[model samples]
Target: MRRRFSLLALFAIATLPLLVVLAQTSDAPTCEIVAPDLGSYIGDWCAIWIRVDDPQGPQTVENVTLTVTTSPPKSKSFVYTTSRYNDTFFYANLSLPYGRLELTATAVDDSGLQGSHTIWVIHPFPVPYFNSFDTPTIHFFESWGEDLTNWTISPAGTWHVNYSNYHSPPSCFYTGPFSGPITITLVSPPINLTNWTGEAFLSFWSKINQTPSFTIPPTDYCCVEVSTDGRTWYLLSPYIVGYWSWSFFGRYSLTKYVGRIIYLRFKLVASSSGGGAGWWLDDIIVGNEKKVLVLDKLVKHFSCDSLDEWTYSGDWSVCTSTYHSYPSCICCGSFSGNKRYTITSPRISIPSVNDGQDIYLRLWWKFLIDQDCRVVVQLYYDGLWHSIGEFRSSLKRWRSSSFWITQTSGKRIKIRFMVEGYSNYASFQGLWFDDVTILVFNRRIATKGNITGWFSTENSLWRVTPIRCYSYNFSLWWGDTSTCLCYYGVSYPLDLWVDLRDVDHAYIHFHAYWNFTDPQSCASLRVCYDESEWVLLDTFMGARSSWTTRQYRINGGCVVRIRFQVEVYSSYAIGFFVDDFAVLPTTSDTASPNVSIVEPKSGAWFNFTNVTCVWQGEDDVGVCEYEVRVDGSSVAVELPPTTTNY
Candidate 1:
């Protein structure tokens, strides 16, 4: 019987006492390995602690063991028993070579029921330098042996490193104050450039604050040089002129010297008698190539050979003639009587200051008048129409118009040419508009004096007379009246012009009353920047009467024209009255004055009585006087010039 016993039977007999002790418990023992988190790098020594528990009782757990398996072809396993107080703890003294190691801990109960947990640890080798200077001390190198006499590595020179000054943190090397003539070279540690096979670049942020009085000689300047071997060096960058502001210098390709280890050095040579502030460098990165994106300026020309970049409404036709530069030009308005036609160009995008440019529009136009027909140029921007200038061809000669587009930076805008005719009394030859072009100029030299005359109208000083007025009742805010009769099948178009040379915004307030029989009969109020096309502001149909106020924020153009048009198609319309038409221009007011009329609400009606008028006015500078107007008319009441209320 002793000769026939197997190896498995012998191992069971050897552990029979421990198995018998664990059989008293019902549940398996649980083990958890806590110390040395995943991906943790372990050096010479690492502490590992694990907790093992048995639901039956702590005494039911017999032993806890730890095993470490090292990764590689040399795969070796190290096993050890840990000491336990409440839980098991293992202080591992790792002796294997550096690599990845998997540590597993197992708890075996007295009944041979086991539970285990495993974790991976990484042990990485050290490198020389990839320093950002984010820590207290520099990690890589000490001072070089040869560079101490003329060049100093002190921080408190004429150029110092502070949080606001330096491109990166902590400190940077500086070389300055050589008294007379000196040439010094600052060297860097050897960088491995063999791995960078593709296009490689060395970039750094540098600032040089040379005194304005110090005149730098042509031969004496700072330059960058690279060295394959420590003894020989090649010039990498051009001589950089010393300036006061921090600027970026980069994209120096090292494609020629790709497969070699190299060293970068900065050579500073100064012959000037005056000692001045030197250069400061930070955030030196040597890596792959980097790309930067920028916006391009646009220039467009439409010869009108075809209608490729143009849109039209109503009747617009193109004619081929030698009157313009190109073979063809855009022509409109050949109708007999009462026709509205428009030709709209494609939208063009305006380059903003961020795109490093400014923009302008230019065009040539002419009109042929039989009775009362005009050609107008208008700009479409920010969902509104702006009148640039208006043209009526009494001589049928081509005229040119060019204006700087101000308020449309970083926006898309379009151009429109509108031709309108009112009477069919005679055979009329229409309007001609052609040769459109747009130009984009660089903002570097043109950006100065960006504050153009934003508010040209000072204290409502400028007033505009209506260019053309037709069948409408007109009464002054405080003066006389003109009357016209209501009639069907008639069209009335009133054109008013305002000079917006330096104006930024204009507020127009008026009282309007309209009574019409047909639902299609309407009174439309429109504005234009170039006066070539009309943009409708408000349209009133059927019967309506109210005091309406509208604000026009003007962009960069010289003139603004408004047109009030009333057309009755089938039935009678009466009392189309528009009064108290006021143009108030608030120029570029840096600080707005506070104004209040406490006595009456806006659009409030009053009767003849003993009424006390009160107002409150204040400004950051000082309120000069309160100009009180009753019913849109200034009352001639004597009061103090500095009076805040009436």
Candidate 2:
């Protein structure tokens, strides 16, 4: 019988372990201390544990939370979910205060059964070593998340907020029935960002729902105020008050003392002059969110570029709109002078294309003017019509003029041309345009000057045309004068002269007419250095055969005797004309040098019986001087003295 009792006792002890687990499992799993067996875990060493369920057969738990309420009951909720007949685990690694930490894990299923376990957290504490230094200050846009712990947030409300692009003015948010002065609070205190230049704005989507809001219903007044400190506030200008039914999502901008350690607040003084329904505000955006100035291109086609078409940078289109439609101007030709042979291409809508970017609408025009005339270039901007820079052409030369539209309003821009006549008839033929370029002028180089005579005296003639009529020191030789010589021929040399006053540099230019016959008729440019010496500085030939123009820089001092000698003429012969003569530094005296040096006692005996002499001679205008010594005496001399050169 004693032997039988021993067997029963063993069976009872074995069943007791299963019973303990069954009780815990029937409700919720208890967090069992697996690693660092309870008493063995003395000092702070990561304590971990696991639970074994011998009963309760795979039960799911709900409302499972971890409450670490030590001296203070702080709790963090954890979601515990498990498939039927499966086991689940709960884990956390937190720095508990160096006291008795009361850790409780509880689970309540949807059926509402509660099971909890408490662990005593004690720490002898391993002395942790920490070194601190100034970490780099991090900056993030308003779009960044709030969970960034390593970074510091300034201007309070940076924490407990999130950003989403889904919003209209998209911004940061915090769940709240909270309203107070928004401020700049450093997340990592003691680390201050000095002279910070941060700007933030509050943008919300609002719409005038009812008609009263649009008609200025009774009592709504709103204002945005800012402050350098969280306390003292200053009201900003332009406050919204007395609403109308049409006013919807409202937005206010505040920018005065931003970047400063300041606070911003939005206050609505509800005063319904008589008081009705207030407006609704949604999608509020706060924090540093900047709106990008977006530019949208509307009509890209400016013109139809046919064979004689124009190339452009952006999408090219025929400028067309409701008010105006551009004509098929692939090739621009003048129909007549009195009636402008104008082909109006469509207009294009350009919004904000003037943002420090280059804008050019280039078109080519083969201006075959049968007579002297001017072509008017027009441009439209800012709801008004205007002209590109004015350009007039009489010959077959290609010319371009541009206008400026400070900022693009809409995408549409128009370019128009008009032929105005100062004379009988004018026309443009064989005109073409490829790409357009808009030149931004920072500063323009000075390029205008007086008329100097053309070197080609015979083969080339300067007609008294409006664009050619220029007065200079040489104007005395125009007509009915013995000195004013005009000799006309096919290919030959001609002498032209102008009595230039004080001048340093003279700009010489000429235009050659090409009939395509004389393919070789070219003018050789030369300046007479002395009475007999002609220095060929540059040459203008048939390469510049088509409406040819050449500019030469002549050093001013001696009066220039200019000459143009034509090399050859052929079947494709054409007449050449030159105009637009300019002399720069018009005050430069070109008179010959006069010198009489005075110094060192002329012809006087120096030390050790050596004789020395010096004299100073001054020229009323310019002096090209050199020193000459005869019999050991310094004296006024000529440059490349006659004795030396000879």
Candidate 3:
């Protein structure tokens, strides 16, 4: 009884302190833009203003920052201190480029709570930019507005991009629920008319057919305005309410803003106390010269045609009820675990004679997969299926992709699109295909950019994610290690392999940056002789959360593939980063093979019709094949180099 009482007393003592602790609740800091009138612009060298507050108290706010972003240019960040806040605003002065920009304001409290907001604004663009509505974000459509889309920007044309109407086809900018009153403005690409070269004019097509509103003050209105500094605007076209038809509004002179950088504004409003179809504009051309607007070049490989030529083994059919696109698309929604569903194409055979041009298959597709599920594009040749490429990421937008058929340039083949599941997951996923186009070219056009070292993370859990990185934070490798759920005693290695192809000696160098909270992880190096089976060379599981330079030497041959395998038992932290993984081939085999016969000893052979003969061959890189010509007749020309008596 004394021993039991003592153990109980110790247990109570161990947890007694935890019961009396007071934990302070942390609230995310509130962040709001106070200056530059967010979603617009300020001076190129002026400061940005923001207002930050914390629910706990102002003292809880630790850091406030603003990130000015422009694609193709490195983003810049500015810090905000409490000293910069003058009771009403937090000022962050920065020198930013003129044009369309995105400002992201973030606030962090002392307890790591954060709040952030991002808004797009106009800076300016050099004049003469053009837009034909084919590619909305192209340089010609340099507006930081969400009102532009190649397709419908919003749904059902509720002041959004819709399929109902386009100056071209398939896309346009629209503005309004019209259920109430709304005002939307779209800015044009930057134009620096500081150098007046020739005649400068604005050209576009506009359409509006509202059945007038009951509000007499301003029923529905659209006007063209010009801004020299992106903030102060001067009306160029009077507010034309109840503007009708798809009329060409053109030849408006923009020579007045010749001494400064400028941006054209399209301001639209609808006071639809009673409403109708909203306003739309397309084919915007602004410059020192006028250009004709033409139809958008459509490049659809297979126009939503019949599916009679395609064959599928699972539940795949044409779907039309969806709102997105591809009025006719091959969709596969039904799934079975540990099974592969494929959609096979009819025979895609080249001419009997071998042509030298490379074969490419380009298509538009979208897919979403659960754990261990993937979509693989394959080609069937010589009675086998070859996986040329695979997609593992869960993509929401439609993707256009092209893959080269490696080494099958002159062969007759058929293409296969398949989806595979590795486990019995209950989550729902979908795979859809819009069109497939086959093209032949003298050279391959595309290359994989995210190849870590010489290895590809296709069809593996190891991939490049923005979660964590050692450098270039966006597309760095995370090497997420996974374990197989269906197979016991097996782990799904975060793996990437490269073909060494007959080289037996090489050195691998890479950088490892780890952020692990007592992780039970393994960084295993392996080699694959054949395409499938892998052999472990070594494993590394040192201390976690540090940057280390890793170098490994490998000795393997003949279709050799190097792999970095990772298996995670459990994880608590961000990422195990793999950077600059590369291999250095050290094999220098330039000498000829040394061969010596070891049979028919000194003319004392047996009295047999066919005498058995043997020879030994050796090379620095190992012999690929043994060719033996019996009296110049090529009797045993094809033999394995590993065997001399076969």
Candidate 4:
């Protein structure tokens, strides 16, 4: 081979002169810590790799070396071998202790040109630990095997350990504001719950402070998440900072993952456009606790002679002697002017009841006022107070009153008593109440079928037609569908009826919406006890854009019929619409009246000539009439049918 120079010898000899000249004039070789960059958490045997490159040739590179300096004053060095031309690769299998390590790579060319790069790496311990950051000196590793003791702070300057903004004593971890788009997460060690039983809960306290402008788009969001494997996570709670306050996120039941190993992490994400005061967290806990639900019925009798279950606002007291029965009664009294005294009963619940069952409130009360004082009973229903009944005039002795709690079968309710005095001349004795009772019974009529008696004549000028959705802007009633008694393009009256044959003390309820263009346009709701005569129950005048509930209570009757009449004064007005029409039967009062002679004792003789007599009368529904008699001769004057006294 023409003096037989080997290939290796020929390559080295051909590049030797060129490599020496290039190394003297070229820049220093560049070095980069490609593997395990800054802020990386590694294990015991970490493979640290570095790449060194030179612009000259591979023969221009002299040596590549790696030096790892760890805490506790320990150091190690490794030399790398080049495997490719113009590029040198260096790697070391490092058994790093649980601490921070400073990795420096240096590359020196044959001409004495050198380049160096330095990075930081962390070796963290394994999990199942807690950290409060209370230690005086910040260390990369703790004597105990806790990963958070050697937690990696990314980019080196974003996180801080301080005593401010902590819920508990000592210190907490805080993330300061940064320049632009950043995501910081504080992760907890693995919590092994594989052998635990029952229910488990995770709870923590956190506070966030941010700019308090509503117009700005929210750029900061914080949440807690849990992971089974470290790669995937499920969010627990996500919140944006609306105000600066300390909030305790109490136990969130993690019963769904009772028997599995999990990890908890708090993540904070922020954007550069809007700045904030950052987030603070402390007192994190995970434990085994079960949550309970309450589902119990309410029952109160007031038989213990105590007002403990009631709340009163104004002049109220408990009296032991002057009551309906022996033990006690609630006494409200001595009111003047237009002053009112109110007492509210505790909240009571009625579980689901059958269709035809009835609920009643029974109580005994006595009032000593003359004319200007009244006692009104109200029931709280559907966020409003409805007056059930009232007691006026003088009742010198105890009387019983019963009210039907209709339309509230499966709800929670409260009963309120209001005593008001309109004048100063009323009696000072006030009102006395006792023996409050709530009872449920099956007293309603078993007939529960819909009335099949709606009549509309096509030849008539006024007819009932389905409401047109396009004409009224698609405004719907309670049932979203309705019928209107329309006399379109005319000014005539419309009539509609539904028959109720044997309904006893029934109520007719319907929803109505009307738009009257003219002032004289009106509608009248009526009921007929006899076929020829109609009794006006209610009348609607003027305009109503929204639906209004209308109800009428009819006395027990065999030939009852409900009718609606609408009259339009002008043709420009849109006719009325009615929906959800139903006849509901109420409980009938069958008990006789309770009468007592309170004044003028039975065997006592009268001394004066014009002795005014007083007596008490009460009934469940009402005391319709009262008749007075002396030795069965009807000597006393007759009182009105609505009178409760004589």
Candidate 5:
């Protein structure tokens, strides 16, 4: 009886249904459409979506045909079709001239099923090639001062830490590889003037003895030291010898433990080996340690469900049984035997709020079957989930998906996979995720209130004309150069007159309007900071079919004169128009008015101690007061019309 049962079990297993998957023999399918509602299709931008719905068969729906016609049977007719995607979307480019339009789709299939949808087309604006470099806002912090003397002098012209007597250059020196401790000190304030943290650097010139056996003691070469109270010191690290022509002058970095007044000290440890010799030191510098903000640090992971975070698996595409704790929902691997694949856990949570800026999402996935898969990522727009885009899986390889999340609002999002098997044995593996970043627009540095003077038109190319030839704050003359091509191949001729006070850097931004008169064309704008010599900052080419704003920065101060010359070398007619030329302050330059005594005050005076003096100050907006200085010193007492001071 046991042998008979075993035989029956084996037979049953062998009789199980054989699953078959077909290859995708066509391009990505078009959108499916729904029949028009009421008297006319209610919404414009209507679409017809389609996709292969059959399994164990050819996923390709060959020779698909679509016909769209208005209700009144007007001459206006538009037709388009999808070769594949059991569900494909189609729509008329410009809607029917009359009230309503009907759409029908038919494809060759064994099932012989037909699908149809009615849609209306509204005036569609050509999708802009979202340029992240639009309007160029730059967050360039101008270095306050240069390290004239290597003595790591900070912007305030002092060391980054506190120290002993620091007079001038010839005053600094180094002493012998001691029978005693060698002392090094500098006098100055902290590195970062504001709420700064972490370590800072202090540079000073030191001349070591050339004696071959001379070795600076390990303890003697300690990192520069810093202290808040001038006592209870802290050292950065042990010093290392730096290369030099005459002597070894090395710099060290020290952590700033104190703010405002800081003291720096370096002590030479007693060394018994490597030349018990001497050295000389001079020129000390102090500055804040450079800091960097990585793009990865600022990114926040998200899920459509109630989860706050996404899970990270040790292996790509393979998920653990457990979900992420911080971010509630995560991609869990649908495990079967040794097989593991990622799948969405239902009821996911969207984050409470988005980063509220332009962000990018990267997805890594693998399929374990011979099929084309799609991961539809939906964002909570308005009140429901709206599809932003989808991550698609190819025939044989694991594919990565990426898209920018431009929508700024709403929290929850939903992600689901659409799998169409060309063969039953489809699967993906070894998926990895990385390099996800959000780019914040930075263009202010190029277009802020740094204008000089003058405004003029440069030239006219491709219907672009600069009214004036002379260079000014708003415009400039770009030498005229012509191409034998008709109006279609006209170059971009643009002149800028920049008010030195109104703009500082020159950025070329313009839009080529595409209309019936002008079909397609390309042009470029060139700019140079010098009127006498021009350096081409950028040469914009490609479909000049839409408005585009571009910006570039050059190192200059006040009204740096520049020229913009346009050159077109295409035969295709293109229309070009440019405006919104702006030069704004790179950063928030709003500063508090500084009060200084400019008049009746020059130097320290002890002679006329009781003299009545008048003072004045200047500021960005306007001067508000006159201060009084007596004997090279300022007093809190207000100035009197005809008074005396003591």
Candidate 6:
């Protein structure tokens, strides 16, 4: 029996699924330049991160250094103190002058073998130029502030960059030691204050609460200092006597330093011991011109479940099988297709950039046609249809694409997506596009008010992204720039506060919209309440043609916080899109809103255009807006939130 069992076991083992495992070899680790891909027009700040990988494991690889070939082309090494992409990188920042630079990132494994990757970078702005800092590392200022070494402590900066309390929603220069008293210095690079009038000054936002330390009022204060030629320094005032609660927007004259280049720094004094959320400074403007950015989210949602707002000329049809959203998408020419098809959208009246607004054209689509075919997106206005974009390549997956409508903004234009293939026997099998929308973003700068929450982004692209943000960025350009270097994409992780103190149960519902080509891209929502450990509520992946509704329930808690995080990789199909977020006391409703006609009886006949209809509706919360449909065709939309007769 033992011999028979042994023979049977051998046969079972041979029939089991095959597994493959790789062991570490003596090969040297390789360096992946995760950022500033090849050639990037660098602004005032330049950040370089390199992913160092080895067969033994990226963590086992030792030191990584970056060298720039400038000024006689000698290699200068910089210390990379951080790792990213699941511990596949060692990265750092560099301050360089305006010109072309060839950067070499070299990594060495524990075995002492070396690997290197080099790329070119250009800093176009001339020094003494006042430009914004959009990168993670600033070249306009040489930071004496330290890198973030421990998550338990504040990050590097003499005036540490903190998010606890802010004049801005997310970050500001702050000083206060959470663990103990420590002095940090943040100094500016050369600021040529030459040729300045008496009005030329330096200014920052501060308050007494910035230095409300436990040790003493004045000891833990934030000191503003200045220097010329980077040597001797002098203190500037309102000389601190005591800390206050109100914010002081101070503007100090720089008339004395006008003849030469000067330096400025915020000093966090050593006596700033004990726990205070720390001193805060933000919106440090050197001149009088203030740049304010206020984001107003205006979304025009058009359901593709039916193509009433569209027209097709050829083989295009509404498909339901595979879509970014559910139920439908207008498509034509499937895999290996060769047919000409044209679809036109209703005239889109976009607010122009001159109106302090930008228009974003977002759509979800997939194409599997041949290279000989062409997909052209054209805008018809000003007497003729002008081409906005054209695609000749083959993309087979459902993808989200965004277009920053330039030149065409402010014009009422009709868009046409035309697919022309010379072949006779190709079909897209339909289901190529859905959820076409026009997003209008209006920015009002210099507006005073708090506009942020506990939202943070890890990538430099998200820090100052121009478009596609609801107070946060989903990508460098909400479109396909293909800057897939590091985990080089969008990672929007937001913390939403929910008070479930007295409630027994609550439901969280949100409309999730996404189209990610990379299998690694994903989104998650985690909940924490009543001082409990973080509990995962749910996670979502895969592509969708239409929006998906997800709801999770929390039984009980005091103050609750939900963290919604999204990490995208490989493609810029779309950014993290989760909307209609709500925390309700009950999971009573997940269906359509209830509506009742107060005046019109059921099945009553009335003239379509002459009759008046009075109706009232209530969604789970309350009525948002109402749309009236007659015979399944919308006659009126976005009616007043208040129920009324139409």
| Stretches of candidate 4 exceeding 4 Å from the true structure | 1-299, 423-428, 444-646
How high a TM-score does candidate 1 get? 0.23
lDDT of 1 at 71: 50
Overall lDDT per candidate, in order of appearance: 0.55, 0.39, 0.56, 0.58, 0.35, 0.56
Candidate 3 wrongly placed segments (more than 4 Å): 1-301, 322-326, 351-356, 426-428, 443-646
What's the TM-score of every candidate structure?
0.23, 0.19, 0.24, 0.24, 0.23, 0.31
Looking at candidate 5, the ten consecutive residues that score lowest on lDDT are: 137-146
Residues 1-646 of candidate 2: C-alpha lDDT, one tens digit per residue: 9999999999999999899877655654444434434423233335344343323444444334556543211122223232222355544444343333445556555444566666654332121110011110112111112222332444344334434321222232232222222222222111112322434444443222121223343233444455665566676424455433322232244334444444444444333232323333333323332321112222243334342333332222342121111233344434545544454445555544344332334443434444455556667666676654333423232323223344444456566655554554644443444334332211111111112112223213322221211221011112211223333344455544433324555555433332223445555667773437888966554433334334455665555556655544343333334443322223444665454544454575556755444443444432334667667998854332111110
Compared with the true structure, what per-residue lDDT tens digits does model 6 show for residues 76-151? 2334443444567666666654345567888877777788898976554221111121111111111111222111
Off by over 4 Å in 5: 1-222, 242-260, 274-283, 288-646
Q: Is 4 or 5 the stronger prediction by lDDT?
A: 4
> Candidate 4 residues 1-646, lDDT tens each?
6556687789899999999878566577888888887956676588877787887666566776777664321233334443323456767766664445567878888768888899976553221111111111101101111113324445555566656556544555667654346677876655656545546667566677554434444466677888888779898765555444656674566678767877776777666654567777654656542321111222445652777888998888888877665457988867556677899998888556565554667677776664467778888978988776655544455655656564567788899998887776644458788988776653311111111122223332332222322121122221111243444433233232323334457666555677776777766777766557878888777778666655556765444545566665564556566654545554676777787776677888877877766666765444434577766677434333224311
Best by TM-score: 6
Worst 10 residues of 3 by lDDT: 131-140
How much lDDT does candidate 4 score? 0.58
> In model 6, which regions exceed 4 Å deviation?
1-299, 334-339, 352-356, 422-431, 442-452, 455-646
lDDT of each residue in 1-646, candidate 5, tens digit only: 9999999998877765432112333323332444443233233345444433333245533455667654221123456754343333323333332133445554454444433334442111111112111222111111111112222322232223212222232234334343333333432333332223334455444444422323444433424566666667776545644222322232254443423556555544433343334444444445432322112223344332332333323222323332222112233332222332333323433333334333344443333322233334454445575554433332122233444444532343434333322233534322322222223221112121121112222233222122221111112222233332333344434333232333333232322222223223333444444445556665444443444444444433333334443444433333333343433223222665455443356785666656554443333423222444656987554322112110
Better candidate number, 2 or 6, judged by TM-score = 6
Candidate 6 TM-score over all chains jointly: 0.31
RMSD of each: 35.9, 37.7, 29.5, 33.6, 29.4, 32.5
